[model samples]
Target: MTAETCENGPLRRFLTVSNKLAALGAIGVSIGFVIVIWVQNNHTRSLLYETELQDSIRMTEVIAAQLYGPLRWRKPSIAQDTYDSMITHRDLHVVAAVTLDRQGNVVTTYQQNSSQPFNFQELRLNAGADLRLDSTWTAELDGKLVVATPVTSHDGRKPAGTFVVAWSLAEIDRAMRAMFLRAAFITIVLFAAFTTLSLAIVHRQLSDPLTQLTQATTRIANGDKTFEIPCTDRRDEVGDMARALVTFRENVALIDRLTAEQQQQTLRLSNALEKEREYNALHREFVSMVSHEFRTPVAIIDGAAQRIERRVGKDTEDQLRERTGKIRSAVVRMIELIDSTLSVSRMEAGTIELEAAECDFAALLREVCQRQQEIAKHHKIDLTIADLPSRILIDAKRMDQVLTNLLSNAVKYAPDAPDIAVKAGTVGRNVVVSVRDRGLGIPEAEMPKLFEKFFRASTSAGIPGTGIGLHLVKHLVELHDGNITVDSTEGKGSTFSVTIPTRYGEADAAASAALSA
Candidate 1:
């Protein structure tokens, strides 16, 4: 090292590591002492000034009383004598007495050692006849206190003139200056002594504990978790830090065990992710196979039912025709199930599209209600559909499927419910379709996850469902820029509402016959 570097090395180390507690303590105490001294001095000065001002006001009152008898009787000599006597006080600067007549004109004036020219007329005008018996002082008048008092009769009935006094504050200011200097000197001496004592006490109390803590921390940083700070018996902040360091060392030892467990958990999570991927692949394959395999059989059964119905003669037995109708209805239900599964698959793949066209929402709902009544022969379907304007636009096929799923769910869940109500109406710019059933209502907790794929309510235990119906309904409705909401009470009933936008730009004509037909 060079000469300059050698000289600066110790200073550099000290600057980097020295605690500076002594210097900081000295500065804080000094500032606090100065502030206390300043506040006390200001308070003392205010009290002294107020006392002097009050004394001046009292002197004016005494002088005014003496002059009152002379001025009322129009005795100028007695009044002038009182004014001269009052102005002889050491601090008194000017004293003036003036008498005014009924017309407010000055009749007599006496002033001794006057500081400024006095206009009796102006003074009387400003201090009106009804002025209260209180003294007024202005601080901005060059450290002088000014008082205005009314000169009246012995009974204090009629005011003759005004008495004004001006008192100098030079002596008061000089005394305050001396007092402040003495207070400042004493405060400085006390601050120095207290700061030195505080520094010594702080060093005695804190330096050894802090030094031990630093050594313990250094050992911990160098991977010695067994090291302990030697100041745990202290009750102050240093002891608190020492205890915290002990806990930190304990935590450092525990971290190695946690790291090993974390590696095990990570390995387990990786295995679980692989199993989830396998399960998803299997689920997809099952859905695809069900859709492909069920469609052909359902089509074959439906075609056979149709052919039998067409060829049936009037002589055919009612029982045979009923069986054929049942067969066709069962096939239709199976087809609907397969189609719902396929729709969910398409939605997941993001390939489903809505074919928007002007549609009569009321007519479409009436048709869906009729079909549901036929399919659910044991239940009653009450349709309260309103005639919506033809300007509403939607995809007819998707909308039909949406209604079908809701009606099917209602029939399946409320098998013993005597009647289900299907209502359609126009609300603002949207067409709403509601299906309600007085059956086992869904629990409130299940409503949030009601539209999630493959999520069935606890009440749906033993009810046959693929759990894709409501999810599909939600997706199809949203595809047409619509929303669905469900309101259910635990043992009363449940209502599912679907809102679809009415895209009619003022078109109100029917595109087909009534759906009931």
Candidate 2:
């Protein structure tokens, strides 16, 4: 569709055809009626003006006849009295009159209400030597018509004088204006009545049925299959439209039902595909974990045993003991890996339970610090303990696992760094533990996924890890109803902080009070 079609509203879309037909017919009728009235009015006005002109000339001739005898005797008083009497009859529209001798010089002038003394130079006389008796000429001056008639002698042989009379056409103009107004009023009333009647008929015959069809079409567009089209019974184009709409509705409903079933199938397929992908990923992770983590310890133990067997007779007793010690250490390392994996499984199965007890928070942190220092012989583990609460409710075994993972990560990731700092303090009603290492710091982009399972930072790529240490630590901390946060800058250092509530709930409150006391 074009831009104009898109911009069309409901009235343009639905009512356009019927409305246009009604409007065109009304406008055509109105224009024709106005034209007819205007032409008739103009014709009537022209005829009325002609009649008025003839009447003025006739009146002038009659007055001139009355003045013929008076002008022959040069009696100005009798002509003046006649003019005064005519002006007094207001409907005559007479304004002034003048009498002139045969030489065209004014003999006398008479004016009604006001005087404009006659100027002989202004008189335009067209009388000829062969001018007929009772001959008349007319001219217009301002808004008045001036009629000039010749006064002849009783014998009809000689022109006696000229009689001029001025008649106003204002009355004629007023009558014409009234006639025009009446015609205009009648035309407007008839136009409005006929236009309204035509629109009403058009609305009933065309617009209404079309509107119902449009509504049904809209319902179908909106996915409503239940709305019935009522016009299908009539044998017309609208009925044809209604029947088509019913068919369209049925098709749409069928499509909707098929679409719903297809959607259900699609959802089932998606879920099954996702589950298969997850299973494949878990299998890969299990294989990688076992191969990478177990291979090193197994090889180390095997090599140590082989060396001990080789030194059976040639080496000193100390050498055999040292080789055996190496084998035992490798075995212990493998056992720890197995334990961590088992702990993960138990945690996932929701079978690992916490044994809550009151423990010395600072002492626990110090002991973990000493243990990390021994394990990381090359790196110093510093302890920075503030005045922590004397006791707090905790699951000691789980917390030890949490601290060990964090410290081990520090030593593993920051092997070349000089020291790791383990900090403990009380902030509000919570105990805070932090492990900081001055090593190759984590990248900013890697920080968000630091606690995610099987995810390792790019900086830790060369480091030996199953990638579950921090992930396990996070779960342990959260299981104790705590939160953990990390702050790190690239090439500087990284600090992981854990905050644990001092008391679990009201059950721990009495124990906490006794511990504080």
Candidate 3:
């Protein structure tokens, strides 16, 4: 054979038009099959991981519930028994279980296999497990799953401790590897058959039109909706596909327009909501100020009338003196109320200022206790003072309002429980005053909203209150650069404590100067 004929013999036959089309078809089918296999593998892996995670979480929650009683009662032996009973099952794959108290102290731990000990310190460092016992948490670290859940108190009000469980992921990993191998084997077997079928079916008759439609779809998928699809004129499946692409493009454009309009509407709604919130806040403040302003005058008038009615008879000198004293006390409270009302008004105007001055704190407490004691004649007010300065710089009238409201709440809530304790002391340059009442203590759920304006607790049902006292007290205390806290149990009692710095800038300077002289 000549050189030209030798070069064109088998190579030319293989590169014929029919053979070229077959090769292109086989390549396309192979790409499609690989994508399908990859997507299936990923989906299977995700489902397995999610199932294992959910199982770990459910098991941890069960263990926490079972150990609640043992943890709460401080019975480590019972806690161990609970853990062993629940975690000893081999199918559970529980490597270790740990219980931590509220202070993050490890109360008890159970290990499934002591020979292969689980390193909790490694888990803590690698899995970011710092014992956040407020909520349920789960993490995957180094082929292991960790699940932690809060063990709530008996009342289900708060978390008393945390229960943690670790699960071995070896079985899951092995199952995934087996699945992947099976998928690979099946894919290899099916690829040859699929390529042969695609090569036979995709000839010149369909390849050109399908390729054109594919390009048009790719452009549309890339967010170019203006590209005109081809081959719609022919009465064939390719023509039908082209028409469908046109319709899809139109739908996408319509959806885009509608999304833009919806976003505009959402923006308008958000602005309207913000305006409504501002108006509501201003309206509530106005209402609270008006209500308190009216209440003080009414109380003063009632006290004056009561004294007048009681002293109707021919009274002795001592009785006349006592009546006058009671009338003056009522007037003094009325003046204090006016001052507080002005303070609230200033606070609303955003210009509130504290009138801190040297005032006798012990005497003020005694006076407030006396007033409340007389008002709640059925209840006894016990006052205790320790290590308090003789005089501290404070807004005397505002402080009076603070103390009076606390004492009044104590009296009003604890109607049956007669003894209300008021304790005051100095701690590290701060004065702490606490009011304790054996009344219907606030529910745990309602504690967060205790100082919210117009928010009354569930326990305060049928009580004559506006739920503004504590809110106002908090605002006044904050103006003095102080904070207030409440400790209460549902049926036990409540303690409202206020802590304020004893030395203001001016007071500290004056004391320094006095010492220097």
Candidate 4:
């Protein structure tokens, strides 16, 4: 079949590919042009409105100045003459002008069209109850611009009366309408020319060659591999596509071989993923068993100590009482360690979340210090709290855990140090709580890995720790949309500071609510 007959056979019943592309291009260009024109029209109208408003105000000021003497001396005849002279100017387009005395009684008035009714009472109400003669006031009402200027005495200290003028806005409206019509006509002409040119170029450069390529591709799709693709010599994208098709036919066997190998690789990956999933299941089971196994004995030890203390009361030796107290303390410490381990596991499994609420932060800090002091009798914890908010939004239980951990670390790491300083205050829009201790400070080289999981500083060699306290601390702080930082000097001391915002943002609050739900 001839090329023209082939193009018209079935494709012409619908829009051809080239025709559709040209039409889409025309639509996009028209939308962009219309948007630009709309913005320009609005900007031009604003400029014109502002220009006319200023000119009206200036003209009213001049009329008020001329009428100052006439109203001051109570010469109604002269005031009428001044008002008439001002309104007679053709460019002013004054619809009605009125001069009123200090008590708002009309002294003299001028109306360009005597047929229209002018309400003096409405004008007085618009001027305001105070008369406000010290400055000018302007308003637009019923397609008219009204300006009221003060006519002051010769000394400019007291006002004698007010000069009010109303101008018609019809001229401005007419000008804007004319501008819109002209722009619409130009847009129509340009759009027609652009569409015609785009169609011509698309049909010449794209439609004919793509038609031949389409026929060749159809033949290959039907298993006619001996058919040749045309447009191979054009030195453009079309020629590249034609050459790529030839290579595709030759590599059919290679592609089939690679696909089979890929299937084998996918099967191997699936088996590895299954093995990893099984390992994770076993890990979770182990954590659950450890939690139940460790808590039972600790609870028994704590209960036995309490029973012995109650039985051996007045006749008990001081040493015996102290020994029982140590047993209970040890039980508490073990429980804390178990909880921390579970917390880390939950975090890794992505099941940990915050239960944020309004908390009394100051009371919470004082309680933490008191509990830490009870455990570490040798080291005194000195708390210095500044003016803090009455209530702060935070996860109170998790925050209590954070403070206890910090205090415990301070007492454990600082063997010889006698005191720990705890401070809480507000900085900018955040709340900052810092715990400082006089201990063997961290090595500077290991500072970068301080918050990494299972990382321990060299200075913590002799100290009893699982090396996950700071890492867990950092993670918990970040969950509250906060951060923890440290400052230390070797052989001196270390200060760990936590900073968090006073409240969560709307998006965070919504997410928290959804998670809770």
Query: Which one wins by lDDT: 3 or 4?
Result: 4
Write down the RMSD of all candidates, one decimal each: 31.0, 13.5, 48.7, 42.1
Q: In candidate 1, what are the lDDT values of residues 79-165, reduced to their tens digit?
A: 666655655543364544455444455655655545767655545554455555565555544455666676666677877666655
**Whose TM-score is greatest here?**
2
Compared with the true structure, the alpha-carbon lDDT of candidate 1 equals: 0.74
> How would you encode candidate 3's per-residue C-alpha lDDT over 436-491 as one tens digit per residue?
99999999989998987656788876665656678789998887778999999977
lDDT of 4: 0.80
What lDDT score belongs to each candidate, Candidate 1 first? 0.74, 0.78, 0.77, 0.80
Better of 2 and 4 by TM-score: 2
**TM per prediction:** 0.44, 0.53, 0.45, 0.42
Using lDDT as the yardstick, the better of models 2 and 3 is: 2
Overall local distance difference test of candidate 2 = 0.78
Off by over 4 Å in 2: 1-199, 208-212, 215-279, 313-325, 360-363, 388-391, 504-517
Candidate 2 displacement at residue 487 in angstroms? 1.5
> What stretches of model 4 exceed 4 Å from their correct place?
1-320, 505-517
Ranking by lDDT: 4, 2, 3, 1
